[model samples]
Structures are given as C-alpha cells and as structure tokens.
Target: MASDAPAGEVSLLDSYSPDRPPVTAMRIDFSKTPLAPHYSPYFAMVIDSLLTPAECAAVIASAGSNWRDLKKGDSWRECEQILSVSPDWAKALSERLAPHLPDEIKVLKKGDVLSEHIAGPSNLRASQGTSKTVWRLRGADERLSFLRYRPGHHFKPHCDALYSPGDKEKSFLTCQIYLSDMPEGQQGGEGSGGETRFWPSRTGMGRQSKKSGGVEEDEQHTENESFLNIEPKIGRALVFQQRMLWHSGQEVKRGEKFTVRLDLMYNHHFEKPSK
Candidate 1:
C-alpha cells in the first residue's frame, strides 16, 4: 500500500468504489469477546499481531498526502447513497469493498432466514444462525487522517455522527487502528493514558452514564474507576457501532498517541429488501 494519500478513491464511498485500492489481501481475525451475546450489534473488538512494528510505521509514513486536523463530531449528516446504478459494475465493485468491512455481525435469527445481509465478504448470502456484526461495510471515506495526541492533547466525550445512509434501515461503524502507542513497552511502556473509553450502549436498555471531560462515568465502576478503557495496542483494531456507543479518547500524559480512524456504512437489517 502506497503511504501517500491513497492513489485511489478516498471518499465516504471509496472502499466500495472501483478506484479504491484493493484490500482483498487483508484478513479479519476477530477476538472472542466481541462475539458474545451481550456485546452483539453494539461492540468493540480487538485483534492483535496483525501487523508488525515496521509495517505499522510504513502505513503512517504513507499517510503524508492529505493528513488534516482530526476533530471529533457530535453527529454526521446524511453523506451519500450507493445503488446498483450500473448493476454489473457496482456488483463487481462491491466485491472489492467487502473484505475491508467488520468481520463479525452475528445474525440474531433463531433459524435460518434467507435474507441478504451484505455485511461480510464471507457468507454474504448465507443461511446461518447468529453471527458476529462489526463493520457495516457500506461505505467509508477513503482518504484517512492521523490523530496524534501529544502531551495534554485530548478529545472530550462525544458520540460519532451517524453517517446519513439516506435510509433509516442503515447505520455506521467505526474502526481505530493504532499507528503508534506511547511508553514503548520495553521502556517500561506502562502505556500512556491514550486509551479509548467507551460508554454504555444507547440502544434499547444499555448502560447509561455521563462524560466529564471525555472520560465516561459509569455506575458499573467504582468511584475510583470511570468507564471501560481499552489500550491502543499497535496492530490491534478497535471496532464498534459509531452512533450507538458514546466514546472518547483520553488525554495523553507521558508520550504521544497516534491512531487511524475509519468509518463503515451498511444496512441495520431492520427490514428486508422488496423483491
């Protein structure tokens, strides 16, 4: 992968566009925790050892093209729509985009329901029971920006804007991959305070809490503890529902924190398509 801004399509729909770089060689090795029943639909899973230290560094260097100021948004307006306008061409284009989507989107069906859940590159039209649901893989911005939190650089608690799928049946997903983490483990890398803190789920009846300075205050944790904080492990990806989860990155205290954030779009499967 060339580091400079992707030489291909780099927009919200880039992954599904013909000009987008081919990601078919990539793999999704999901963690066991993100697939649990309680975590389904709204989850954040991590996969370790996918990239070596050097490869991770190369990707960062390649992002030199249009690295812009990374900021947090409270909401995302409807961005765009993707249809089978060029039926044959779009289908082929969708194939290239599938692999980069979230790995697990457990179909919650009690029995085999023959409905298409275009959420995965595998079993795209399968007849399986509950499966993992991670990335919607609908569409995403191709050009990526790196967020480097230096000492005292921090983002406050907030929910990512829901990308207007132009349809209510669709939602979005977010992926955070660490380019570099502070404290350098062997250097007694206790890990900087750059952990991504996730609040309780807002859908149905999930955990409820407020964020003070981006740090979530969960009733589940003791007064000394705040919300659930996941360390930014190099090569580990943190994937979760973009709108459903209230999350924030903590302030960097000791060293610097670098991360690449990508968004995924797809159908929520609330309804089946009309024949």
Candidate 2:
C-alpha cells in the first residue's frame, strides 16, 4: 500500500472546499483528561463528490432492500440495510475512488457479523496523498465489506469489537466512507439526525460506583468526553482507532438517509500480539 501524504500537504489546519469540506483539528491533549489509557488523538476527514450521482443512486437502491428494522427503547437495536454490489462495480468504484476494497464482496447475514474488512486497491489509492498518515499500517490479504443504514434506523452507541474470546484483539481500525449526500431536511436542523458520532471511552471510575452509579456515571462520562459528529457527504471517509473509541450512528429522523460504511481490520497477518 502507498504511504501518507507529506507533512506540508497534510495540514492539520488547512481546509478544502467545494468537493471537500473544510479540515478541522482535533485536540491531541489526552494527558489532562480522565479517559481510559486506550484513548488516542484519532483523526478523520470529509470529502464531497466521491462518487457519481448514478453510482450513489445504485448503491442506495441496493441498500434499501436489506434494511433491518428495530424496536423502540432498545439500547443498540437499530435497522441496517445492506447490499453487496457486484464485484465489477465494487472494483470499478474502488479503482476510480477507494482502491482499498477487497476483490471479493462478502454479504453478511444474521449471527454472522465479523470485526473488519480488508482494504482494497481503491482505498489505498485514495489514502495515497491524504492528510491522515496511517493508512499504510493496514495488513495485506484482508477482507473488505460495506455497511448501510436507512431512515428510522439507529445503531446505538457501541464499540466495534469481537464479542467472542479469541477474536477480540484482531480488530484494528474502524473506517467509514460516507456514500450518500447529507439530506437537507434531516434532524440536527437542516442536516440533522443522520450524524455519525464518536464518544470518548470511559475509564477510572470506582468499581463500587460502576454498579450503584450506573446512570449517574454514564452521564458524567458523557459530559467529560470529547466527540466528533460528522455530517454525511458522498465519498467522504473517516478512519479511527477502534479499540480506543466508542462510536454510533445517530437516528435518521428526516429525509432519506443512506450510507455505505467500510471497515479495514487485521487478519491472521497481524504482526504484533494482541494486548
């Protein structure tokens, strides 16, 4: 895979326009905070017009059929609409844009969720000259998959990790490439509810307080944590250290919300042992 862009070209303060959103700096000061040791200064970017209108529409249509609905008051119960586009389309788009997608697109079903997808050639190509400087750290021979969400569907706050014993440490980075236009009439205001939010990890509260002060502690943690709520933009992708961050998809209250999320994770080729 290619390396990151040069320092001068990858500005932490510089902003892009029209096709790209203005770049913003995230606070790297983790020392003074009370967060868990895993917390890191993760980075992300938003790029507009990543795909053509026809491509976006095709992906959205495919996703619309696979949506799984959720019930009210559920913690992390949300509906997900998914579709594994043809390999040709996947490769074409990946080649033209995200070269990091795997050559094979695997369609997942109930009870078959895995940690991450391998980055394809398209992914590597897009990262070649980008600001985020860690794309080359990805492993080779990894698989890649895309996730979709529709209106009224919400993925509650949760970290993307292996729920099983052996596979927990294999997950590396959680990358999401936004595949739809941020609808104008959504929730937060004009472009409201379809925001993707990342909550800071919570750590160090007394063990006794953990059970007895559950609600209170959660509220307190929420207040102390720093978060990034990104507005959707076609072709824009965000990558972050998974184990160190807690993230979720905010509800899609208004307008049609469609997003194609991809994950780049480690496989058996992982170099270091899991902590």
Candidate 3:
C-alpha cells in the first residue's frame, strides 16, 4: 500500500519510551472461516489484552507531529503515521508473542533495513545458489504505522499487499493492535461501524477478465461486502495472513478509533534438516 510518511530513518524510540509490563495477551484462534457456511481453518486470530491501556496511550502519543492525513477517493481515508523501534524492542515484542504464534512464524533474527533490502534488487541469483527457499520469520517491519479514524473515516475493501524487502525477506502477515475501542450498539454510521469486516474471496482469488472486441480486458473487483464484524477493544489485537483475505475498515461513527499496524517480516532461506 502507498504511504505518505516521510522517508529515511524515523525511529519511534526517539519520541516514545517503551514500557515493559507483564505479558498479558492471550491468543484466541478462529476455528473456522468467519461468517462462512462451511468449516475451514482460518489463518487469523485475536490476541486479547496484548497491551495495557497505558501502553496503547503511549503508542498513540508517540505519533506526535508525524500524523499524515492519507485520504484518497474511496479506497483509503484515514490518518497514518510511522515510527521505527529498536531491534531490541522488536525482539522483546517477538518474545512476548512467541507462545501464542505458530512455530513457522517464530522470530529468529532482526530484518534488514528497508532500503538495504526493499529498494534494492533481489539478492537471490539463480546462478549463485539453488536451494529450496522457505520464508522464516525474521522480525517486524522496522517502521510501525499508526492509523487513526475519526467519524466518517474508513478504508474500502482491499487485500493487504505483501512487502518484499528482498527475494529472501518478505512480509506475509499483519498484526494490528487497537489503541481505542468503539464498542457495539453505539449508533451513527451503520450501527457504530468502525469494525473490521472480512468478506468471501472471489474465484481463483484473482481479478476478472472479459473479452472485448477479441481483446481481453481486466476488471478490478471492488466491493465492500462482509459478514464477519470484529469490533474494536482496547488492548486487543487482530493478526491475519495477507493471502486471499479481503477486508475493510468500516466508517467510524461517534468516536475516534486508533490502531497500530505492524507487518511480520520473514527471511526466505533454505530449510535446514532436523538432526
């Protein structure tokens, strides 16, 4: 996704002091596809009490003067800001989340700087090496983004895009920690509609194509349909993979809603055989 935050090394550690409180978050896995008729394992879960109320406040305050209004047409309309944390801090967070996460996503090391990997060409050259590569969790994205939504703010239905720092390092999962809660029953925009909703995936999970005058034309699918509604709660976090999932942020109604989004970075390397 396109970002508006100023480039270069913008560390959040400069502004916000991170506090280490007792790890209190507990993971609640979704046994089946949300709002779906048939039973199917889902790659998303809610980690309750991931942060304390004070921690959430500290993160929101960390944005300070960095908040950028990223409103564009109907696709995305929300305020966003970014801050990078120290590798130590990121490692600490990874440890806290380790018990709840699957083995495949275990953080093994810090990731490369965005410029060193993302903007550069793929480091993996077929001529140099040829080993089967599998994505192994490295750490979180260096720059963590904070999103704010006031009344009438929202993001349209769209799938989260993968951020490939290098051919060996890419992001496939998203972790969004909620800072403010907009509970249910509050009336304003479609029954207090600041909830994150997920919809059914399209066939092949790809764009549609139609033949026009013997030429095929690509049709971009655009719709805000959803059946599952995840209401915001202070200290709650939503973690999901960026595969065929299509979701949106429903418009905020009466109050303000805030969230901190972090992508899980992974290193693509040849798997080592177990002894």
Candidate 4:
C-alpha cells in the first residue's frame, strides 16, 4: 500500500508493463441514482458496458498463464490472475469517474487526537505536514488483480480492507469489472450464481437494521436477509465505498466467473483549494 501519487497528480504504474492495450471509458449519470432496492447508496452503483466485449476478451487473454489459486480456509477462495498495465488505464478511469464522484473525500489531520470509537482510525489521518480535512483521487492502483472463480468457488461475507500508505494516501473505493459472463446454457443461463452481493452493515450504524448470527452461522447467508446482488455481466463495473459496504462473491455454480479488480486511491491535501 504505497502512495500512488501526490494529490491532483497522475501516478505512474511502476510495477506494470507499458505494452498493454488501452481501455475505453463510458459516460454515466449517477446523479439521482438510488441504491439497488432498499439499501442506502453509500456511493455505490453499477455501470454497464464499461468495457466492450472485445476489450474484456483482450483483458482476459492478457492474464496469460499467471493465474494462481488463493484459499484462506473457507472464508476466502479464488483463482487470481495478476496483470501489470500502463498508467493509462487508471488515468482514464480516474478522469471519467472524477466528475461523478464526491468533491472531497474527508481525512483527519495527522496528529488529531480522536477517540478509539472512530470507525476508520487509519483513514482519519491528515497529511504529514498540514491539517487535512479533504482528500482527492490520485490514481488507480497499478497492480491489477484479475480473479477467476470456478464452479463451487466462493468468498464469504466480508468487508474490503483499505490500502493506506503512510498518512497521506489511502484506497477508499473498489472497482470490480466483470470480464465474462457465465457460459451459455448453464443452470440459470449466463447470470446464475457468480454475483457480487452486498449486505447491510451489521453494526446498526449503516443503512439497514442490524442482524446477528447470520453470516457467522451460515457461510453464504442467503436465507438471512435481502441483499443487493450485482450479477456477472461482461464489461459491467461495480464501484462502491470499500469501508461502508459488506460484500461477497457468491458461489459460482454454473460456468466460470471472470472479473478484474481495481483499487482507486485517494490522497489527502493541506487545504481545500478554490474551485
């Protein structure tokens, strides 16, 4: 979790190769968009066709043979494919998404004395030299993680951890781009079980009411409460606040599931500059 770049500056993808192909950006109107059915928005939304079918195919092929299996007990499991791409991918995405994102992502001052009850102790820090109450998207993380889930592969309910480097920068949002749909003619057709589902926070401070003993008891927790499910669709990107949302990659029972995950980094600044 290194600082990608200074605020308002572009980060060079140092770990990525510069030979990767370019990605196209889509214009979306997220204003007035509501969270799926009943959950609060929490800066979460889906953008369909963010990448073309050809682009998705190309991205999948780019992974080549780098696929590696990751399993940490029963809580997490997936096949990961890592790709190093030029900074253009993150630059284009950050630019297109900036206008739609909130103006200021808040962060506390570096030495501010706050109680332990604060939700994000690490995220509340300000820049090293100045009092910072605002943060802005610096760039996308260059290390792209392309995940593949075969039938029966799944991740249990969990919240995405933040990537904070030093006191100046951190990752606040995640962009999960679906690369391929379930193969045709499966049990429930293309969009069957491989879904990025979201549950309301269990601490009673979030949108929906708190629920207990559900996720811990049942691994998938499909029977406990109504959740927002974003099915696998080629080129669809699910972007949400990483800290506030509790999500899981439901078990894939049909065909293979392909997705590219990107972390969007934000950097705190000393002052709120005039727009």
Candidate 5:
C-alpha cells in the first residue's frame, strides 16, 4: 500500500481523485497473507465480529437510565448528567471483566475531576506500556470517562489529552471503543456523521509556554487543527498515540445516537506487546 502511493502525503484524501479508482481496491490483507510492511504507524483496524449480541445487550443494560438522553435536541447539560451513569456501569463492567484483564492492568482515577454522581471504582489501574490499553471495561480508568458530541452536539477539532490536566503528558495513547452501531440514514451515509477523526499532529502543535500559561490561551488555536474522521463500529475500538494526533467525534444527523466513550492513559515506561 505504501509503495503504491508517493511519500509525504499529508492527508488520506489527497491520494485519490474522482477520476481515480477507489482506494479500497488497493487493499491487501498482509497480516493473513505474507506481504511487505504496508501498515502505517497511524493505521487503525476494525475488529468487526468481536462482540456477540448478548454481550452488546449486557453493555447496554449496564448503561441504565443514562441511555434515555440520546436524541435530537439534548443539551450538553443534560448529556453530561446522562453520562454520569457511566462510572456505575463501568464498575459493573470492571467486575465482569476482571477474569479477562491482564494481571498487570490497573484502573486509575482522579477524585477532584470526576463528578459526584459518578465517583467511580476505587481499586483499578492499568499497566504502563507502549501499546494502548485493552478494550475490556474492567481495570480501566473511570475518571477519564466522558460524553462527547459533534454539531447538534458536535466536538470541534481537538485532541483528548489536551483538555485533561493531571498526567496528560503521561497519556501516551487514547482509546474510544464504540458501544453501538451507527444510526441508519444519517448524513455521511452509513458510516458518516458520528465519525471519529484523526489529523496528523504537527511538531510543536500542543506545546505550552510557561511565560503565558492558561488553559484558554493554550486552546486558542485548537480549531485550526487538521484531522481524519473515522466512523464508529460496535464492539470495535480506536486507539492511537496522543502526542501528534488530533481527533474528534463528528455530528449525528438522524436516528438514535449514543456511544460509551472512555480514555485510556499510560505512563512513560509502557510498551505495546505483540498480539
């Protein structure tokens, strides 16, 4: 795949034109069939058939009353309140996922930042590694749980760690696993709207200066950041390095819209292990 395209392409959309054949036609399953290194460091994968219907139901059930707030005109205030149910569900998910989580996994949380409605589980922490945390809800950091949106409830171009305060630098990777499928007939079509976008992180993009240090000042240029949008897939997780990557959720158009989104942080000593 890399050889087919010239080097230094800035955006995925750059390599294709209306007259050219679709890029999907060039795809090769190098992982299953022996081939050269085609996967880019920023590549994302979709484990389409990972979760069963029963598991999906259990996850939705764990959401409780929070699932009721997803709709056309819901305010952020209402959505935030609805998101409060996550820690409770996350606790239940943690307990259920205990046996499957790696022995080194640990769930971490910050008491001051979390809402009173969702204080979260006390004894969870994740192991430090280069790879992103596993999608298993157990042994995951609950304080990092948050509800996201796009126009309608849109989140403009921005990265996750940039908004977080404590240990933000320690968060080497960020993960958002989809809890439900995309709504039908939405703009952008089947996988449009509600897409999670990732843009190449320019050098010195997120660096801060002590001379003029304030959250608002630091965030002044965030809107101009570039990114690539990814459509959500149920049971599939999106993970990537946080340093030079910009990402956000696209707006939803029609039909029901809801997702269970969380962030996974890691320390400097972490390394991703082989699958």
Candidate 6:
C-alpha cells in the first residue's frame, strides 16, 4: 500500500539514511523482466523525495524561462508540432553549481546530480576510485532536458534514440525527474493525467507507430492489458533504459506536468570503482 506521508513523499528509497547504515537509493528489484525483448532488468526505479519542494520550484522557474514545443525525432521533424509537450531545456544547472554550494542547500541545488547514481543501482557508482563523498562519475550522463506537459499535452509511445550501435559515449538510459504534479499544497503545475505508461515486451503496449523509422511514440494503447501505468508525483524520478522499454506520456487532462529528462550516457572504460 502507498503511504500518506505527504503529497509527494517517497516512501521506499528514502527510508534508509546514508550515515547510520549507509543505505542506498538504488534498488535491483524495482522491476523485473528477463524476456523484455530489448531491455535488461539492470536498473529501473521510481525514487520519491529525491528533491525538496523548494528545489522543484526552482526547476519549474528555470524551465519556464524557455519552453519549446516538444518535437519528435529529426526524421519526423515535419510532424514535430504533433507532440504536445515542451521539447527541451536550456542547460543543466546542477552539475555547474553543485561544487560551490554548502551542505544544507546542496541537495536542493543538485538533486538530479545525485540522481545519476541513485537511479543506477549496483555497487558500480557515479565515481571511479574516489574516496571523496561527492565524486562525479566518469560517464552515464551528458544532457539534461526539461519537459513540460500542459493541459491536453503529451508524448506518444516511443523509446529514446539509440546510439550508434557501439558508440562508447552513447545514451543508454533515460532519467526523468517529475518536477511538478497537481497542486501539492499550492506549489506546482495544475490539472492532471500526465502518467507514464510502459509495455512489458514487444507488446507495443497497444500504441500505434507514429513515425516511419525515427522513434516517436504515440499514446494509442488506451485499453491494452499488457502495460503498466505510473502516475507522476512531485519530486519523483523515473529511470530506465530506452533500449528495451516502450513508453509514452499520458496526456494531461486538466493541468500541467514538468519533468527533467536527462540522457545517461555510457563510457566503456573507467579508472576503477569507488571505494
């Protein structure tokens, strides 16, 4: 059963502290599917309370600076107007600011920064042989995109763009931070219905193929029995590999939803694992 701690408190990963027992946010058993056809059960988790309300508010304000009419892949540039969400954002502020902030407000300024590893389970960390507490990993993240979904807006079913088969610096995972949901005590976007849906295997989750070959998913599998629907909540983040997961963003029925989508890149070689 879900807890009622707050409007958007994450009950699972946040329960353990890093000091007393060194609890980790990454979980290996959040979702499993050996026959997923394309993805590995390697890591996919929805972490709650990763960000504070104040931090989310800052992100909301940051994204509001410039909201592009979200576009599909380049192959369907002509149909770019079809997507109802905001395209992307200006820049990633956390990586650029995390080093200078104090301990108290540091987490708020860099929630997504910590998210890089928290979303990626396994002892393999966001660092390479560093005893320091805040070691930025060598790879796994390159770009951070801010997605805004307003009333009647949404993304169709589709997976992320695949790298050049074996590009050492390709994006292998997609990380999303749910910046806003409902009202949450009068501090967020309005309306509702911005849930994310995913299909287990090659099910397509009942959605229709929109683009010819560039990977622009549409929301068409409304009645499919083989998909799972995940609702958006403030300060929650969803991470998964796009190589195998077929997903779509549900249309906002009433208000708006803000999400920070970061492209987790990959690097084959590393100095060594963190100590």
TM-score of each: 0.53, 0.52, 0.68, 0.67, 0.47, 0.55
- Taking the candidates one at a time, how many backbone clashes does each contain? 21, 20, 1, 2, 24, 13
Candidate 5 at 261: error in angstroms? 2.4
Give residue 18's lDDT in candidate 1 (0 to 100).
49
- lDDT value for model 4: 0.59
Candidate 4: regions farther than 4 A off:
1-41, 83-88, 92-131, 184-191, 204-222, 272-275
**C-alpha lDDT of all candidate models, in order:** 0.46, 0.42, 0.58, 0.59, 0.39, 0.48
User: Which of candidates 1 and 2 is the stronger one according to lDDT?
Assistant: 1
lDDT of 6 by residue, 1-275 (tens): 11111122212222234432321244324235432443433346666666555667765554335445654454222111111122122123234222322242111111333333332332223344443123222323423456677766767667666343353344545667787875433336544677887754444433333542326533345464465567797776676655546677877776677777765544444443234
By TM-score, the better pick of 2 and 5 is: 2
Span of 10 residues, lowest total lDDT, candidate 6: 1-10
List per-candidate RMSD values in Å: 10.6, 13.7, 8.5, 8.6, 16.3, 12.5
Cα lDDT of model 1 by residue, 107-198, tens digit: 32212221122222332333324443222345444434356767666665555554443542233456666768678544655556788876
Query: For model 2, how does the per-residue alpha-carbon lDDT over 163-246 read when each residue is reduced to its tens digit?
Result: 111331233445565666655673445554778876665434312222111111133235555665777766555655444355
Q: Which lDDT value does model 2 have at 63?
A: 34
Model 6 C-alpha lDDT versus the unseen true structure = 0.48
Q: Which numbered prediction scores highest in TM-score against the true structure?
A: 3
Shift in Å, residue 177, candidate 5: 1.8
Candidate 6 deviant stretches above 4 angstroms? 1-42, 71-142, 163-167, 183-191, 203-214, 217-222, 270-275
Error of 1 at 245 (Å): 1.1
lDDT tens readout by residue for model 3, 89-193: 455445545566766344322232322222222332223243433446766776666788888888755566666767567776788888887756644435656
Superposed on all Cα atoms, model 1 deviates from the true structure by an RMSD in Å of: 10.6
